[model samples]
Target: MRISPAYLKSGILVSTAGVFGSAFLWLLSFKAMAFWMGPEGVGLFSQLRQMAQAATVGATFGGTNSVVQGLAERKDEATRRQFRATAARLVCLSGFAVVLVIAAAAPLLTQFFLASSAPALVATVRWIALAVLLNVGGTYALAVLNGYRSYPYLALAQIAGPAALVMLLGGAGWWHLPPDPQLLSGAFVLCFGVTCLVGAFGVSRLPKLERALRLGALPKAQSRAFVRFAFSNLVAALSTTVALLLVRSWVIEAKGLAFAGLFDAGWTLTFNYTTLFLTACSAIYLPRLTAAVRPEDRRACMLKTAYLVLGAGILVCHAMVLLKEPLIHLLYSSQFQASGEVLMVLVIAVIFRGVSWVYGTLILATRNSRILVVSDVALNLMLLASTRYALDSFGSLQALSWAFVLPNFLYLVFVVEYACLQNRLMCRRDIWPFLLAGTSPLFYLALSGPQWANSGLVTGLSMVVGLGAAGAALLAYKKVVS
Candidate 1:
């Protein structure tokens, strides 16, 4: 059941490159786009992007992720090839239909969001529809590459798409081209198209592409299996998407777009950092977890993976929290300084998310999509209720920030409990490490006092003490885990 060192290393490299490359481009794009378009413009763009992603979740029917999981589980070449062909045909047709619906609905959707705002808002929403359409095709290709475990090609496409878009936009800006929503949307379409083409080339490298491309290559049985696997997952993906949109809309309506903008910025930064690490581990471990023969062995591997990922996540979150003030000051303007507290809350939620992925991926690898679907529904419900209550009571962005933390923590608890009960996770070792790591933040916060004594040196000294405490706690954690 042990993973090959070479494969593990390769997976790490590919995942790291892909995650970091995408993150870099996105961070740069946001900075550049915000500089040109202003905070509200970036906020509008963010809202549009989230809407498109939500639409894509509906349009793709959630088959992409399910396809990868199913294909990873398959051993027979014929079955895999048949599944691929069926998936390809279904995804393409569904994507096209979804695009048509989105286009048709764009006017009404834009009108609703604009709500007596500028005409430019309506135009931006229309362009976002086009971006969403192109994204659907690109996402399918990326899913295919993931299914085949073509990590290098997937990584390459991930890098190329964002890098190209950023370069193009930066060039345009440098040449004094006015930054308009249309230009931004066009950049997205172009990048996505290029990525899709590159992903097609990658898929062609698989052994059975020619056979898969042939009409009627997939038999009825495989098609049935694919549908069975993909349908439930689609529902789960769609529900999650709805939950996100609901939260965003609620924030905008109740609080305001400016507050939502701050939340978005903080959430984006926190999620990218934590997800990059967790995703790297999942990419490497999921296939091995799937290929495991014995329940006990699989349980052991899952526990080890969880420990490693959670440990890493704790370290990263601790560092960020400790340096939150200084980091916020350095990266953002005074308008966004309040985001530091939001960032702290988000970091905690993200740590739980990182840990939950290990258990979630194990469920996925085992074709237990039912568990994922159920968990997602329950968690989303909790998130919606909590978010609503928080906003109603606190009426601050921090309320939204705090709302994210508890649901994720509860979800992680549920996932771990289920895994243990199902005999797919063993070893109580994770509990002690989690408790110790979780308390490190309290120690850091305790030493910060009420104020910095109104001196730059004192502020610097306070930060040093907080970070040092966190470092000591982390080292202690490593020792205990080892």
Candidate 2:
């Protein structure tokens, strides 16, 4: 089977648009939360979200990637059905277990995380647990859709969840809902449930999925493979989650809740928007990488993906650094204006993250779970350690962005070396794009510094030249990939 560039382009556009919609909707919801709840309120909500994410990752039993890889590689319907059956049973059982654990520990969780064990807070935590349950199922459905390369349906399900949240948030105004943590957590549960239902409906509409759902028992061998993958994936996912949580908690403890809120505003912008580039290519790239048997073919897929991601990421990150002040005002509030500095440095980290995503996808696609697990854990650990050091040395939350930059840059080096040594994926031609893309953000940083930031003529000229450079690179990359 041939990989058409047009097909790749269409899939990327649709998937990116869907993710953009979700990001935009969340931005709207966040703007309301910022207005009503203020910076400290946003901080508390961010903590709750981190907790939900951790629970959701655990609930899935690390089966998300396994399901995607399994279905993508399996050719026979019967085999795919068996594997899907195994994944379903594993995720369902694990999701239930996670809910139980969270419910049982809610009071303790509230005391620890929120620094109080109030009954109302426990209830709020329990609501988040429910969201985790729903989100787990939703994530599983998404993995299946991704495995089958169902881009359009996958896009729809992605948008529906966030759209539901926006609608619920809007309804809250009409319903006179309290802007407490409970209401926010409940909205999370409702939106996740909606996403799950939409995704399941899409799964049902698949030609083979209905029969697959009905016919197979959970095979022991497949279950073990899924479990193994789950463990590895869980470690990586939990590491990243817990690392961020710890960092946020540390910031809250050190600088206070209001400061953490500002940091989170910048983090939200950096993480959400940068992920749009990854989401754009992931749906199509993973399945294609899994299906390609020859090393040459895999290498080609990796190069094309890296170029597309880097090309787009460089441009977007550049614009973000340039317009971060206004963008922050637009997405958040004037109160969050201080986060502009954070956003400026964070975009460099975002660029590094984009580079890592490209290579990381290849690592995951090849099912080199140990490498993935180790690199992820190490990177997160570096992030935590470096963050503490940076905070102490610089004594500013804006300096937090530096913690991620070096670790991600190191991770980029680690993965590129692995790709070359273990799989021979990189060539001489691939070197320049990575170098150019990686350094592009630095140029933006330089231009945005105190020395040149005030010069409108310089900034305007830089924007023109930067965008032109991006377009030329895209054209050149198109020629190479084609």
Question: In terms of TM-score, which candidate is strongest?
Answer: 2
Q: Per-residue lDDT of 27-66 in model 2, one digit per residue for the tens? A: 7777767766778877887888888888887777553677
Candidate 1, residue 316: CA error in Å?
1.7
- Per residue, candidate 1 scores C-alpha lDDT tens digits across 1-482 of 23367976787788778867877777776655555555555565567767777777776766356766767777766677767667778877877787777667766776455332455656666677677777777778777777667789888877777777878766775676775766777777777777777877887787653534554546777678667667777877788777777787777776666776677777767875565455445555766787776877777677667656665666566667666767654544456666766776687678778777787776777667688789888888999999999988997766678788789889888877877777734544555356345634533443355354224565455445445544544554454421
Go through the candidates in order and give each one's C-alpha lDDT.
Answer: 0.68, 0.77
Candidate 2 Cα errors over 4 Å, as ranges = 1-10, 116-118, 173-178, 209-214, 432-451, 461-465
The deviation in Å at residue 256 for candidate 1 is: 3.1
Cα lDDT, model 1, residue 69: 70
| Candidate topping lDDT | 2
Candidate 2 yields a Cα-based lDDT of 0.77
Give candidate 1 regions above 4 Å deviation.
1-4, 111-118, 172-179, 208-217, 329-334, 424-429, 439-482
